[model samples]
Target chain A: MIVGERKPLDEILEMVKDAKKILIVGCKGCVTVCNAGGTKEVGILAATLRLARLKEDNPIEIDEMTLERQCDPEYIEILEERAANYDIILSMACSIGPQYISEKFPEAIVYPALNTCFMGGAQEHGVWAEFCQACGDCKIHLFGGYCPIARCSKSLLNGPCGGSADGKCEVDKEIDCVWHLIVNKLMKQGKLDQLTQVKPLKNWTTSRDGGPRKIVREDLKI
Target chain B: MKSGSNLEKLLNAGEFVITGECGPPRSADASVVREKAKYLKGYVDSVNVTDNQTSVVRMSSLAGSLILQEEGVEANMQMVCRDRNRIAIQSDVLGATALGIRNMLCLSGDHQKFGDHPEAKNVFDLDSIQLIQTVKMMRDEGKLISGQEMAEGTEPRLFIGAAVNPFADPFEYRVYRLAKKIAAGVDFVQTQCIYNMDKFKEYMKQAHDMGLTEKVHVLAGITPMKSLGMARYMQKSVPGMDVPDEIINRLKGVEKGGQSKEGINILLDQIQILKEIPGVAGVHLMAIEWEERVPEIVEAAGLLPRPTV
Candidate 1:
């Protein structure tokens, strides 16, 4: 799932400094799963912003709402009736939620309350490790379920980059070296020889490098 | 024959070309570059001018390389994709080549987080391997990476080079990565700091098996440890470098003030073994912050009287 964290209180306060009636929107998608922008987060943001405004002697109204998957047009259309009643929309979801709301309500000012981070799932309770770069191509099988393109510091397809000492990366000693993890996993499975084959230069055409990508599925189009 | 440069000619002539590095000072001083160049003068075939090495701001590698050129030492302009986009990189290539910078080594660079400008945005629009391919396109094809022709005689001729680290992880693939570098159109290869001789010998053996030595000049990189503290730092803290415990114990066995001498001897032994390796085309001695010791290391390593074109 996509991971994100709440924006700084100062920055969030500054965004709605001039606004009167604002829509505090949340998403039931990845942001909800990550506890970033969910129904509970929406209430917290609404109460916090209102308290801040009340303390400033300029009290503001915040109408809190949560939508099912803020990225989809059908889900976004559900907010059409109440969206026009606000001066701006303060989205607590990932970046995609705010952009979608803004596009649906073209005249309404939209702002994100969370900084969208990476595509990852929770490791423990609060820990999340990135496992994919969305390089648009999936080749995790080559590295025993690890994605070196996203995890390695250099995105080195044929990497480890002489920076792997023990099990840590050169960039930060605290961070585990992804190649080290990959090698250990492969070695455990008795597939260590697979690492000998060098990875070719990645074809960036499938990635964000080739420009905004789109997928069309003929089978599911209808 | 890309630039008919001294380094190119020496490597082509099959002479064991020795190279040295001169990291530009943080301040806007060309004299520091010249100061380091003077130490390497007549000791190395070409001097590598580092580009904001470790992501710290420094005098530009191009400007520093030009200073080396003025000091009568050939320059290998090092470029990293961390600071500039393709436009600025391409522009610098043409500018550096016009100023007589002949050798170019492409690197991905240490991440900016390691430097003072941790907040600065990185422009890794292309990685080191892609940059190598882009430079090759501009030189060999006389065109841009987009396949557009140069306006006239503006193609930048460079003896392309790239760096590889055998001491990283997944050790089996290190040699294959060198082969990939050769396939990326690199004319030469420099390695990361080598302390584990047994691993390096095995790496060289695989490189030779793949015939990489015949296709490109593989200069084994060696950084002489200054102390046990430095060795420990590189072993535990530094990335990709695995200093064997015996080397550290050897340094520790030396008297308190005599560690540096023992360190130099260890490096000298490594260089001697590196020379006997079948595929080693040269040695790149990176005496970081200890530039004054370069002449001594080269003299002891028998790399003096640097080859002329």
Candidate 2:
């Protein structure tokens, strides 16, 4: 899932300082599950902004609304009624929300209130760790289901690069050396011989190195 | 005579070769390299110029190797994958070759988090093993990584090397990693500094059993521990360095200033043991910043008067 976090209040306030009225829009997508941008969060932000503006003696008007999903055009159309009435539209969703809103309402000023982080899942109640780089091609089955491209610091295909100590990465003691885990997992599965053949150089064109990617499903189109 | 490098030639002739290392200065100082080369010029076979070792920015190893070569010293220039894409790496290989560098060591460079520029984005487009294969492709197959042929005879014929660590975790897999490197077309390998001799021996025995030693020359790495603090720092902080308790105890037994001598003594003993080990080709003596002590270490180890290939 796409994880996000709220931007610092000062920066958000600075972004909206020139506007007398703004709309705070939230998304019911990945940001909701991560507790970053949900309906409740939008309500809380609206109240805080109202209080802050009231204390400044240049009080401003604020409106709050949460959409089904900010990424889809169908859900974004819900803002067509009141979007033009405000000086600025503050999106509390992932970065995509502001982009989509801006694209749809070209004349309206759009601002992202949250920073989009990464595509990862929750590790604990308050902790989230990255697990995927979305390299577009997957080869996890080769290394006992561990993704070296996403997990290893060096993204070494044939690794445990001279820096694996006590199953931890040399980059950080807190992170596990994914290669070490791959080796041990393969060893336990009696597949240690699989690593003998030299893995060839990776074709990184499928990764972000190739630039912004797009996927078109011809079969499902219109 | 693959690359006709002094190190490759010495190893091919079955002479127990000795190579030294020099980290390029953090600034653009050619004299620093020349001054260090003077200390190691007659003491070893070829000097290995490190490429931003520990991720601290320095004068490029390409420039450093050229500088060392200007001082009448052969250079084994190191290249890492962390900073260059395959395009840049291949381009640099050609550039280094055109400038008369005959040897190159492929490494997955130290992560940038440990470097002076922690926020820098790393480009590990190819790991060390793939890097070895890429260099070999250019050298033996006379083609670039894209499988496109360059103008005839423009290929970079480098004596490629890689690094291994016998003391890292999942201990049983280290030997297989070495085997993969050998299969990837590495001509030789230099290991992490050996402090845990017992573990290194076991790792070497596994290589010998797998018949990996015959395919590639293995140069055992050693660094003289100058002080107890250095030893402790390596043991605790530096990953993959296996400093045994006995070594620490031995260092502890020494007086404040005598630790350096004790460290050299320990290195001398390691050199002797490394010579007798089957399939061991040479020693890559990395006297980190203490280049002056390399002459004494080589002399005491009876490896002086390096062979004239």
Count clashing residue pairs per candidate. Answer: 4, 0
Residue A166 accuracy (lDDT) in model 1: 70
Please tell me how candidate 1 rates in CAPRI terms. acceptable
Pull out the clashing pairs in model 2.
none
Off by over 4 Å in 2: A54-58
Q: Evaluate model 1 with DockQ and give the value.
A: 0.38
Each model's DockQ? 0.38, 0.85
Report chain A TM-scores, every model. Answer: 0.95, 0.93
- Give the runs in model 1 whose Cα sits over 4 Å from its true position: A8-23, A44-63, A72-89, A100-111, A123-125, A131-149, A166-168, A173-222, B150-155
Best by the DockQ measure:
2
Predictions: Cα RMSD each: 4.0, 1.5
Error of 2 at A2 (Å): 0.6
lDDT of 1 by residue, A61-136 (tens): 9899999898888999988788889888999888988898898899889999999999998988878878788989
TM-score of each: 0.84, 0.97
Could you give the DockQ of candidate 2?
0.85
Indicate the residue-level lDDT of A54 in model 2.
86
Q: Could you give candidate 2's per-residue lDDT for residues A63-140 as a string of tens digits?
A: 888899999999999888888999999998899899999999999999999999988889899788778889988989
